[model samples]
Target: MEQVAVIGAGSWGTALAMVLANNQHNVNVWSHREDQVNEINHHHTNSKYLPDVKLPSNLVANADIQEAVENAKAILLVVPTKAIREVCRKLRPFINTNQTLIHASKGIEPETHKRISEMIEDELGEGVHDQLVVLSGPSHAEEVALKQPTTVTVSSYHLKSAEIAQDLFMNEHFRVYTNEDVVGVEIGGALKNIIALGAGISDGLGYGDNAKAALITRGLAEIARLGTQLNANPLTFAGLTGVGDLIVTCTSQHSRNWRAGNMLGRGYVLQDVLDQMGMVVEGVRTTKAAYQLSQKLNIPMPITEGLYELLFDEKDPKHVVDDLMNRGKTKELEDLSSFL
Candidate 1:
């Protein structure tokens, strides 16, 4: 049994800790909130995040970040994108060269347009760990906590490191696959949240399945466009982290980004929606980053642009949809052919 440390105690982090514990790993979860740590240790519950789910009894919680990573064989960083730098800085002092560092959080860093792995590397620097791996796909934390069947991909610059992460997280209910397309995997995982918010807005605007279907399909096209510009394997968008993640995040009620978008579509103001969710809606930040990146790269991301205008420009959602529909038409296959 290997000792693992999960660096965040949010829903995703807690659920992942349960997965590690179930796999018979000695898992230590670190949370800044003392109350959350106490609740996890004494009651084996993280009610605020995973409301009805009980965490694995073997999964321990730690308030001290140093204590959590002290002897860990692997460390999984699952905090929000905004907190990644802070967490990585905190972890740098304790991280040893032997431990593998993996991150499951998704979202591009606004302004910098850096992926989670890039941000981690910037903060932790070189030679701090065996490898920097990213864990991403369609799996939801709530369902994973219930031991439902889920599959995800792990990617790293090093194939061996990806394989190592795959071995660490794979199980009967939780299957893990390894991919070497770190650029594709990270880009797909991050951009899908932008599409998901659009999906939520579509549904909230009382539009039927037709609108959402168009959003999801064209959204994939937009994602592939930006991804390829960044040198990602075009085929990766067809895989789990790309299409699979987009479908789940865009359609499911479990998605915080979608939920926040729904609130926005239902006429709630941006600040109000954020206040109500009480969680970092990664898509909100991702949309801004993606919008800026698309402009910088001269890539066309209509859906993302629309969402950016709606979220930040205070434009009406229906008007944004109208703007999207009114755009000049182009041959769909013409775009698909470029990826080939």
Candidate 2:
């Protein structure tokens, strides 16, 4: 059995641990909270995160950081995007360069606007990212914890690392695929939440599927436009992490982005929507980062600009929607020329 260390005890971390434990691997899940650690080891449940789902008895949580990291063959990181750098700093002193890092977080850093793998590379620069891989897609923690059917994509700069991740998580109920486009996978996974929030807002405004469909289609275009400039493969945005994640986040009841957007569409302020989310509303921060990056990169991202205005500048949602629909007419695939 492979001994793996998961560096967070949040819902996603726990769900992934369950996936490993079910495969009979020795999984060590680390948590900052003492009570969460106690609950996972003693009660076999992470009530605060995954309620009512019974975890495998063998999977457990560790409160000590060193104990969790020691001798682990592979490391699975599931912390929030904002905490990635700090977590890396903590892990740096303990990491053996050979240990592969499989990151499952989905959000960009606010100030650096860096993707999770970039943050990992920054934290441990010079070939550290060669051993890094990203696991992303539409699998929600709530459903995955129950062993529900979920499909995800694993990306690595190295094809071998991607293959390792594909073998690590793919199962009867959980299907996993490999992609060499780490940039595309990371970018697609990070930005879809921004669109999901917009989708939620559209739903909150009671707009029909026609609007939602248009938002997703156009959102993918804008995502590709910005991502291509950052060296991400254009087709990665067309696959599961790109289109698949977009479908789930923008449509599912399990999406925090959609929930927050619904509140925003109902006329709630950004702070209020965030305050009510309780969990991290990643889209809010992504919107800010993407908006700033688009300006810096000189990429024309009208949807991101509109979402930013609506979320922070008190722009009317209707007006934002109108502004988007009234933009200068262009061909369907003209924006994709950068990829060619």
Candidate 3:
């Protein structure tokens, strides 16, 4: 069994740890909270983050950051995008040059407008291997922890990391695919959360499946537009991490991003919605970063732009929806622009 460390014992982190542990990896789940560590070891229940999912007995929890990083061949850094730097800095002290780091958190860093990989590159420096892999797709932590059938993608600038991650997470119930489109995979994973929030708002506003289906379809176009300009393979946007993730996050009740968006759709203020969710709503902050990135990249991302207006710019969601719908007509294509 390969030794793997999963830092940050949030739902996704814990779920991923479960994936590795089930795959027979000796996983050490690091948590800053002592109570969570105790709960994982003693009761096998992380009731707050993972709800009813019982952690495997083989998966142990550790409260020390150094221990988590030191005893690892591969590390899964599951902290939020904002806290990633701090966690990596903590890890830097104990990390060996040989470790393969897999970053599973999805969200773009604000202000700097960097994706998680960029943040890792900035914070970890050249001392770390480009063997950094990102895992993302339609898998929800809630279902994943329950060992549900899920599919996700692993991508790295270095293909080896993706292969290793593929082996670590793939199981009878969980399928893992490898991709070389790091930019497309990361952007699709991050950007879909924003669209999911928009989808949530549509649902919250009492819009039916027809409207949401329209939003989902149109949202993919905007994502494609930005992904294309960013030099990401447009076809990657049609794959699991792109369109698959968008559908899950935007349509599913288990999606925290979608749940947060639902609250916003029901007229809850941003702060209040965040407070109520008591969890990371990645889409809210991602909307801002993506909106800014679109402006800088000179690409139109009306969904992200509209979500930004709803969250911060005091624009009416209905009006934004109307604006999106009233735009000029275009040919229906599955973003096969490159092939065309």
Q: Pick the candidate with the highest TM-score.
A: 1
**Residue 308, model 2, lDDT:** 92
- Score candidate 3 by lDDT: 0.86
Please provide, for model 1 over 1-340, each residue's C-alpha lDDT reduced to its tens digit, 9 standing for 90 to 100: 8999999999999988898999999999999999999999999999999998888878999999999998898999999999999988888889877788999999999899998888888899866434899899998899999999999999998888888888888999999998889989999999999999999888889999999999999999999999988889999999999999999999999999899989888999999999999988999999999999999999888999999999999999999999999999899998775368
> lDDT value for candidate 2?
0.88
Q: Return the clash pairs for model 2, or none.
A: none
Cα error, residue 226 of model 1, in Å, equals 0.5
Q: What lDDT tens digits, residue by residue, belong to model 3 across residues 181-218? A: 98899999999998888888899989999999988887
lDDT of 2 by residue, 1-340 (tens): 7888999988889999999888888899999999989988888889888889888876878988889988888899999888888988888888887788899998888768888888888987757767899999988899998888999999888888888778878789899999888889989998999999999999999999999999998899889898888988888888899999999999987899999999988888888888887888888888999998999888898989999999878899889999998999898867667456
Instruction: Indicate the TM-score of model 3.
Output: 0.96
Q: Estimate each model's TM-score.
A: 0.98, 0.96, 0.96
Tell me which residue pairs clash in candidate 1.
none
The lDDT per prediction is 0.92, 0.88, 0.86
Q: Candidate 2: where are CA atoms >4 Å away?
A: 336-340
Candidate 3 Cα outliers beyond 4 Å, as residue runs? 329-340
